[model samples]
Target: MSKADNMLSILWMLRSGKKMTAQQLADELEIHVRTVYRCIDSLCASGVPIIADSGPNGGFQILGTFADSPLMFDAEEQKALVHASVFAQEAGYPHTDALGRAVDKLKRYTNEKQLTQIERHSSGLSVLQPPIDPEQKGRLQCLEEAAGQRQTLRMVYGGSKGDPGTGSVREFDPYSIIHWKGQWYTTGYCHLRKDLRNFRVDRIVSLDVTDRRFERPENFSAKDVLLEQLLPDPAGDPSLVTVRIQAHDHVLNELKQHWLLGHALIERSPGEAVYRLDSTSLHSYVPYFLLPYGKALTIAEPESLVLRMAEVSRGIAEHYGSMLSGLPSE
Candidate 1:
């Protein structure tokens, strides 16, 4: 194996539950015992926290609670980590801190040659530029503290319409802070309004933590509440709508692995398969699934979604026409 690959293998072995002696590693790598010692020293120097014990039963081991944890990565997880690291750096805050720490850990298990390769690959990656608002950062920090401590806060929040003249100052019992679609929102119980409300963190003009403590509802979960609010109801009906759609084999395989689709009924015919899903907002996701398949898949569903797709097609045609005429697409 290459030097870099050898180092990774050695780290993986050390991280495994089985303790390996220098002689064992040398035999496995087809190298001298001294070379194995040198490699171990290099790993330690790079902050791998490897421990060597001196006894008949003793051997080299990675000294950590996570030593036996699996290091194997499927292709997607590796790509995701690399991409997320780039994004964290560009975000210029907590993500940057996390990315730096992750890179440090990755470097410990890598040799100089592998480090060089990773640096070259990572240099080409970039993160999206985040909006610059120092005040928003401060408010986010305050919100984080309030959420962690379960404290009440008095703040002047700007209205959604962006009229500062109509902004209201009120007290709120912060339950949680959620990031949704690039915007930050703080969901809490408003003392002034006497109701549960979601406030945009960026709209917070002034904030002060209160000494009065509040209790979170025993049955209230942030994720449950968020999903309940997000999933749209068709018209005024709250009934779950089931829709069937044909999907490519690759897409079908991927969807099968998803726990959310466990309740879905699937049928196979010819080169494709159909999935029947019961969701309140089936119309929103049906187009998403169809986009990747193009004309390969058909939506065999509630007639409303079919009409929606037709309208979307008409809109796209109009957009293309306006683009060709050198007019605004909107």
Candidate 2:
């Protein structure tokens, strides 16, 4: 038998509580006693609790609990582990190959009955996720490796609105991998900007881990920082103000689920809600957001916002209306 196969056979025998010596194991497996000793040593090195004794009657025996460690993961545990992998896979987990091998080992060790239960659980449950770009997976992995080692990364990062092909180069100390609203972002200290920034993983055109290393800020959370950057934290700043709106209860419920509006939201009633936001978000994003709701939502305050929405609607109308100005009446 091959070395691995021979080692596995030795382990199985020891697990049976037979207390067999090296010569006995060697005789049963058709291998030399020295080979049996080597196999036991290999198993011990790999964390198997193989107890060796020197007395005339002593023989190698596996610790009772260690011999049966596979049973610790009951059927439910196995199913849960496998099901959790679905979420990771959907999110384009970077080390998918390693994850797959780990899961395969779980399945390989299961009994027929447990395997049937695992299949039953897996077949009955599923998750819906947006498809991720293939290239983002590699970027996520590289960023993870660099962050784990406190290494800096150099890359061409597309600015929030720039095309990836034309992105400028930057080097940053990666801190964490954050998942928000179906998108992945790497939050870190940007060398070019000399400030903390979040770069969309998909918008990374090229990336390389450098030998350079840096310290992560004390008590930092990438998700918290990303949220503060994306939405409402600016609302609390002295420069921002509150805008209140009223809508049907059902419509308001749907609106509150929005990533931007949800965080900005300050107070709400059955028929009204108030959101705190900077002028930029109010004028730039709210108009388009409310346009989809038609008359379902009313801007109860901030007369400026009402007027701004009107201006936006008018501009859009004229922009599209010009296309039909020369067309024949229909």
Candidate 3:
């Protein structure tokens, strides 16, 4: 057996209602006595319930209370757990090593038939996700730990993806870390801004967990905070305007899934969607969002929005026209 399997086997041996010495465990598993001692220590470090009694009659055993407890997952439940682990990893879950160990333990305890079935299910399934950036991955792990342990973090925030590691430094108390779309975000209290804010983990140039501690607000919900930011209550902002659009039926499915327009949708029909958005965004983000649809989408109301789209089209044409002029005769 591999070292990991050896360790799991030792766990099983200890649960037989009989005290066992390290030498006996090593002999039974056909490994070294020292290996058994190391496995015991590793199990303890992993938070397994183990007791070491030191005396002539002393031996190591799992805590009596937990000794009889078995891994309760049946075949289908086991397959589901394996599949879920794959989904979690693909979503860039931090603490992947711990997750791997947990899954290994689950597989180690299952019988032969169940193990074969699990392998078959796992092989037939696959998941696709955006590639994880190493810097973002490290920051995500730190943010998650800081949130759980209530530790404040000092980080340099802001910068374009092409040129990171150059930004303003600030202290933040991470309340939550979440994965949305293909990006990672840490929502928290920013000491610099003196308000709650969310920062994309990828945009964080550098990060360090601080010794400072903080008490999270009572009944805090980071998800709710993020949702409100993405889809604000339009009534609260009197400057907002309603914009309506019509798209071909062939493209409506994808248009309905648009991040900003989809969330702001007030009403919809076969080829039309009405959305309420601040004029600033309507002039900026909305134009870029609908430009790709071209003729498939048509702006119907708010003449300013229609004019802005025309302006965007004109700018694109002028810029490309200049670039083509500079390129030597084709």
> Model 1, range 76-186, lDDT digits (tens) per residue?
454556666776445534334556766666654543444466666677787567773777777777877887788889888885435554779899988887765566777
TM-score for each prediction? 0.48, 0.75, 0.76
Overall lDDT per candidate, in order of appearance = 0.68, 0.83, 0.83
* Candidate 2 pairs with clashing backbones: none
Error of 1 at 169 (Å): 6.1
Those runs of model 2 whose alpha carbons end farther than 4 Å from true positions after fitting are: 1-70, 159-165, 315-330
Which prediction has more favorable TM-score, 2 or 3? 3
Model 2: per-residue Cα lDDT over 208-308, one tens digit each: 88889999999998888897788657345777777899999999898889987888788888899888878887899878988989798899879989999
Q: Ten consecutive residues with minimal summed lDDT in candidate 2?
A: 105-114
Residues 1-330 of candidate 3 have per-residue lDDT tens digits of 787988788886676557888887888888999889888899999988889789898989888676665546667788898999998888898877889998887765554556688899988888899878777778889999899999999988886556655688899999999888778888989999999998888888888888899999999998888878767775566677988888876676687687776777778788887788988788988899889889888889999999999999999999999999999995
**lDDT for residue 219 in candidate 3, whole number 0-100:** 96
Q: How accurate is candidate 3 locally (lDDT)?
A: 0.83
